[model samples]
Target: MPVELVALIGLLVVFATTTLLDVNMGAVAFVAAFVVGSLVAGVPVERVISDGFPAELFLTLVGVTYLFAIARDNGTITWLTSAGVRLVRGRLVLVPWVMFVVTGLLAMAGAPLVAVIAVLAPVALEFARRYDINPLLMGLMVVNGGAAGGLAPSSVLGSLSNAVVERNGLSIDPGLLFAGSAVFNVLLGAVGFVLFGGSRLAGVRTSAREPAVVRTSGPGATTAPAVAGSRLNGHRLATLAGLVVLAVGALAFEVNIGVLAMTVAVALSIASPAAGRRAVPQVAWPTVLLVCGTLTYVELLQSLGTLEYLGRGVAAVGVPIVAALIICGIGALGSAFASTIGMLGALIPLAVPLLGDSTLSATALITALAISSLVVDASPLSSTGALVVANSPESQRDRVFRQLLAWGFSLIVVAPVTTCLVFVLPGA
Candidate 1:
């Protein structure tokens, strides 16, 4: 077979392989690209390897994830969640929207995965109890809201995407970024409200009991031994202060976020020896490995001309139809996998070539990506999904997962359908 045809086959294989397996799409992309580069495309293996790492993308994910972890240790996220819950009592219909704003803002501040969960889970549980609503219903609201938070101006993914685009010589406007994301956020929020919130409003409630043994064990469990680090004090203050400074500087001063985040880790480590030791164990290593592996996959895909093929194919077909479908597909897949940064990192670059001539700019693509991120947030397989289920008593897990799964798929369906009609139709 000819090199171009072989490369094309490889690209299709990668898409199918990743969709069925839990493997990183980036890794699939990298391997496919590398094979094509060597035997098919005739590009040098060394060049493929060099580009495979995508240092910027890796740094962006690692920095954001780590910074959020540190922030979680400081109890800042708990305070934020508590504040939001306090403000929106007894307003069943509006809970999703409120959750959206709070989580989105916290994500912007570089709050970590479990930090987002740890803080929001309790508040959601409390809210469900107080309002006599289903715990799972409320949990979905918080997870979806937190997932939607990735759309905010200062979110980890938003910042990373903006930097990548700008670094590639494309100018980006923050206003456009925020506006497009805001629209996407509102659309996804409504989906959650209807699927999850509407049920609660109609008087569906869960009978989940508080666990008889309240010992911490799983994901959001505060299971670690009650040591000096358990108490929030000077150590908390310094760690949080360092995180704020680093996060603010990265966004405000345009400093490298990864470096700033590492600096915070180092400073915090030195500030309180015991706390530093504890934080090391607390960081989510699986997520970190996933990020790195995914980056490798993305770079490989680019090298293999897989994305170029897709982009050119779309261009050949006419931008309107292809672009709309691509955007929606990206959203659904990203939501399904529950990693906005990973999906966006993998998708956006391939998309840039396709989108250059389309009506949607990088900002618009970012918006669509943000919508996909939110969709994933609401999915039952997401880390947030587990977080929500774990927050309730053992019995409510199955029921809650089912309800949220229904809502998640509904949003995935409604969001793209609506976009095709509203956002894409106008532009396309």
Candidate 2:
């Protein structure tokens, strides 16, 4: 078989197994890509391995994740969420939109997963209970919104993608990424909102009731009032103030996010050793591992001329509509196992080659990624879903998880399918 055909088959196998068997799709793709590249494509294994680990991207990702962890540990993000909820009066119908904006901003600020979620989750729950709106809906909203954040220019996802694409001799246009990401975010957010329903939001009210708060003694816990006051020294205040500046500078000035994030993480870590150490685990290693593993595989596959051959094979079929749907479906299912970045790594290697003659633009491919990510990252199998369940009241967590699972599938089905038919087909 031709290298392209082999590569396409390998992609299909990975996607199918990920969907059916619940395997780690990234690991599958990594193994498959290397085997095919060496045995069939005649690429050297050493070169493939060396090309896989894009160091600059990984460095920035780790640094930003670490810094975000620090913010989570310090309860900085929690305070932000409280402020956001207060500003909105905890309205059920408005919370999703508010969260979309807030999380987007924080993500742009290079806040880590736990930092953003910790700040937003508690407030969302309070609003859900108060308004009698389904907590599951609110949870999905938060997760989807975070996925949007990851796609933004300031996000680790965006930075990594930009770096990868650039290394492949593609341009890294931050403005284009920003614009494309905004479209993806809006469409996915709207789909999540619609599926969750506005009617479920009826008759919800908020009063002077203060929501229950979780006070852990670890990094994220609030300090005693007097202790907090006493510890508010100039150095500590300067570090906190620097974070605010970092957030604004990155978002408003369009700074190189990786550099900005590393600067913040390193500076803050040096400023307060105890706080930095406490925040490390909140960095979301699973996400990083997923991205790295998939990227490695994709790099190997690219070396084998798989994409070029696959493009010709796909063009031979000449049914753009059906092809688009199949790709989107594969992308979504793969994402369920590997998450968004991983899906992109696995699928794009085949997709780019297969759709070469078709009208599918990089933007359309990105749209598929955005929707797949929104669905799978919010699925019960994903970290976002796990966090939602873990953070919900113990009595309601199980029920909420199941509900969110259903709602998340609705997104997986609707958003990706719709984008395939509407966006990809029209472009093709």
Candidate 3:
């Protein structure tokens, strides 16, 4: 049996064990990585730890969760949620759209997609809890909105996609790519809104009367209402300042978000030891474990050449259009588990041969491929989906994870076929 096939089977088993036995997927992934890397791949343990484990992503998850925990503990999240509610005039349905637009604009302004997600998801989930809205709906809105905006002409994904196409000697309209991605995402977001109880939430409004003072139990806990005259005190103010610093540092300065976030979190901890003590334990450790473990196993698969093996198989298909659709499917499936950028870099080049046939429109094919690759970032295993899961209320995190997994897997099938039909067929 091919080693890649065995690794692939192991990956499925990890998911199945997690689903059927309610085991921590991350823990299972870690074990899988160790076993596969050691026995089958002949990779040393030291190399596995150094190469497979994603320390940067780990830091990002830890830092963001630490900061968010402090915000939740200090009433900053409550204040922000209440303020958002007031801004929407207590219209619950509009809140999700507001998040969508806000994240979209940030992405359009050239913010990295993950940075935008890190900045907004915690707040968005908090808003969902406060308003009795569906967290899945809100999380998906934020993710889709980020993707939509991330395809803007000036955004990182847009610039990179355009550069790749141009470098390959294919002419593409940047505007068309942006418009296609944005419209697809917006339409998808609307679908999520209606399918996930958006219409039911619209008529619901917060009471005019102030509710009793309630405290959050812990991370992912239900939040309490803010006091009538609640205001940011010194600690909350400092925490907010830290968040601003994180944003500016990440977006403008292009600093590594994980390191910068950790630096800010550490500073905040030093400033208020008591608050820090309370907040440290609230970091989403389970989520951290899950993300790190899954990604590590994915890295193992990459190291073992599973991805390349799969890519070669797709490229070997005979028909150009059939090959194109297969390429799109690979992109969708690969991007769901790995980095979308990495998948784009790998798969787009594979499609170059098909494009060279001169029977397909480079613009349409590339556009379809790009959107197909990107739209699956909502999968639970992807960074955006993991962030959403990490920030969800604990009681609902499992449900949210399952929902995202189902959604992501569905996209792996639907997105590629639909995009192929829409973008590739007409041109062919």
Candidate 4:
């Protein structure tokens, strides 16, 4: 069999094993990457490690989680959660939208989507557990908001896509793309709100009542405050300062988030060794493993020509509209397990030839494709979704993972079709 075929089959096996058995998908992906990269694709082990391992992403996950873990350990998260609840007057339904808007603003301000999600998800999930809100609803809101914001002209996603289109000599409306993404995500968020019982939470008052006391029972127990009204102390103030610095440095200075976050975390640890010691182990290692491993396998697939082969085959179809749909589907599916920006880079250009020959609107088709590719960031395999699953209460992590997986896969079908109908068909 061809190396692409072998790599593709290896990917399926990894998914099946991870889903069916009690196994870490990252471990499975590492093995698959090695086998596919070395044995099937004739690449060396050093090349595989150098090329496939996502060191930047791994560091980002570790640094962000570590910083947040310290914040959680020192009560900053509780302070923020309480402040947020009070701001909304204990209206549970509004909390998700608050998170959504906050994340969106961060993304629009040029913060990386994964960084925003990592920083916010733990706090959001804590709020969900404290107030009996659905964790999935809260998590999805954060992811959606981040994604919506990521379409801004200054955002990483938006800038890259705009540059790609412009370089390819295709004209695109940045404002329309941003608006379309934001509106679509808002609509999806509204649907999620209703489906997850956002209405039932209306008028539900928790602020007037005594706040629940979160406690850690034993080893491996998740830590939370027994009461939400804890007054901010020196440690929390310092941690909050560190977080602000992180955000400013990342967004304004364009410093590497992973390196900057790690530096800040180390500083906080040195300042308060006890809290730092407690927070070290709280970093989301499994999530890091899962995300890096999945991406590694995806890198192997790309190196083996599987992704481009499939994309080209689909884009070669004579029917421009049908080819557009196929490209959207490929973007959605590829992006669920890989990088969204990477998918945009690979798939959008594949349609260049079709765009040159066909009557389809470049703006609409590219916008639809961009939306289709990114709308699935809620998938557990994606960085945002993984952070959500990782941050859930221990008892709820598996359930959240399953729910996110289902939601992510569903978007693979629904997003592309909807985008086609709304953007592509109207123009066609």
Candidate 5:
């Protein structure tokens, strides 16, 4: 049997084990990568660790979760939730849109997609619980918002995608990519709002509040909210400042989100070790493991030429329109599991041969590619999606995971077709 086929089978088996036996998908994937990389592919475990392991994402998951864990324990999150509600005047329906727009603007302004999602997801999920809004809807809005805004010309994705297009010698406007993604996600957000109970949010309102003061009496302990809408004490104030620093550093300076988060989290921990130690248990280790393992295995597939093998098939199609759809399909499917920026770099160039022929509209095809690739960032496996799952309240995590899994895979089918019909077919 082909090694690629075996690796593919191993992936399916990993998912099957997760669904059936309730095992951590990350552990199963790690074992699969080991078995396949070592025995079948003749690659060393050292190489997989160095080459396939998503060290950056690991830092991100641990840092963001740890930071937010502190925020949750200290009542800072609760305070922010109330502040957000007040900002929106307690009209529940507006809350998700606020999250969507804020993240969108941040992404459009050039924060990395992961950075935007990481900072906002925890706060957004709090709004979900506080207002009884659908957590899936709230989470996905943030994901989509970040993805949509990330397509702008100044953004990382836009820069990378345009560079690839220039290298591939395709004549396409960068603005079209941003416009297409923005429109698609806005429509998608509206659909999610409705489907995930957005209509119920109308006229719903809650009072604006301040952080209730809470204090620690001894080591490894904390008091509950002492007052509602009261002045935040020193610890919560310091934590909030750390969050501000995280947002500013990540967005304005383009610092590594994970590293910066770790720095802030560690600093806060040092300032108040006992209270900070309390947050260590709250880090989302399982989610960290799940995302990192999945990406490592995906990296193995990439190294083994599996994606290139599929890319070759895309170039061989006789019909331009059909080939265009296939490219979008592959982009969505691949981006769902891997990095969005990575997918843009990997998949868009595959259309070089077809686009080289000048038989397809570069605007429609490239826009379709961009939008299709990014719309799936809501998938549980993708960075934006995983960030959401990690930051979510414990009770909502499982439900968000299932919903995103279904939505992500479903988009693999739906987004490609929709983009093709809306963009490609019109031109064809």
Candidate 6:
């Protein structure tokens, strides 16, 4: 069999072992990458490690989790959640939407999805733990909300897609693309809100600064004092300042978030050695291993030409509608395990010839493909979902991570088809 075919089979085996054994998917994927690269693909070990490993992503996970871990220990997260509650007047149902709108606007204003999630996920997930709100809902809200504005003219994702289209001499309305993405995410957020226990929070109310959260459901649903919601002190103030620095530096300066975050975390650690010690153990190391391993497999596949090979095969069928759906399918599945922007960059070019068929709408097909690619960022294999899993309360980490994976995989199965039916076929 061809190496590309072997690589695809290796991926299926990784997923099967991970799912059936209930083991870490990333661990399985990481091991699979090495096996396929060294034996089946006839590649060397060093190249596998160097080429396939997601080094920058690994840094982003470690730095973001470490900084947030320190903040959680020092009570900054609690204070921030308290302040957030005050803004919403104790109406917990609005909390997720507030997160949705805030993150959406930030993306529209030009913050990358990763940057927005890095800065906001800790506080948001902490709120989920304290108030009995579903972490899945809040985490999804944070991710989808940030992604909602992904195609705005000023946004990096939007600029990249538009540039690709322009380079290919294809024309699409940039503004319409932005609007379509925003609406799709907003609807997804609403669905998650209704499905994942958001309705249970409607009748619950409390003071924003009461220092306690009320549990509205389950066996012992009752008011409980907030964990680590202590009065502000010097260290907490310093941590807040570091968060501000992270936000400003990440969004405005476009610094490498991993480097900037690590810098901030190290500074905070040096300033308070005790807090640093406590925070180190709280970093989401398991999620880190998982993401690195999974992405390594993604890299392995990309390097082996498996993804493009699949795309080329589907397009070769020569049926425009079927070809369009297949492209969207590839985009969704590929984006779930890799970067959405990267998927867009790679797959859009493959669809250009299909657009040249004269019967198809370039804008609709591209827009469908764009939305299909992005809607799966909540996958654990992707950075957004990994951040959510990494930042969640340790006790609930496993449960929330499971929910995110299920949700993400479902999107992988359903998003492409749905987006095609909605965005692509309408213009046909």
Question: What overall lDDT, based on C-alpha atoms, would model 2 receive against the true structure?
Answer: 0.59
Give one digit per residue, the lDDT tens place, for model 4 in 272-291.
Answer: 88777877777777778887
* TM-score, prediction 4: 0.93
Stretches of candidate 1 off by over 4 Å are 1-45, 67-96, 102-184, 193-232, 314-417, 423-428
Candidate achieving higher lDDT, 1 or 3: 3
lDDT of each: 0.55, 0.59, 0.85, 0.84, 0.85, 0.85
Give the clashing pairs for model 2: 311-353
Give lDDT: candidate 2, residue 346: 52
Error of 5 at 52 (Å): 1.3
Off by over 4 Å in 2: 11-34, 101-188, 194-240, 317-428
Q: What C-alpha lDDT, on a 0 to 100 scale, does residue 113 get in candidate 2?
A: 44
Measured against the true structure, the TM-scores of the candidates, in listed sequence, are 0.56, 0.57, 0.95, 0.93, 0.95, 0.94
Model 3 CA deviation exceeding 4 Å by range: 207-228
Query: Tens digits of per-residue lDDT for model 5 on 220-258?
Result: 356676445545878789999999999999988889999
Model 6 segments beyond 4 Å from truth?
Answer: 210-230
Q: TM-score of model 1 relative to the true fold?
A: 0.56
lDDT of candidate 1 over 246-347, digit per residue (tens): 645654555665577667777776775544554554444443443344445444544454444554454455656456566566556454543556556656
How close to the true structure is residue 239 of candidate 5, measured as C-alpha lDDT?
91
Score residue 63 of candidate 3 by CA lDDT: 87
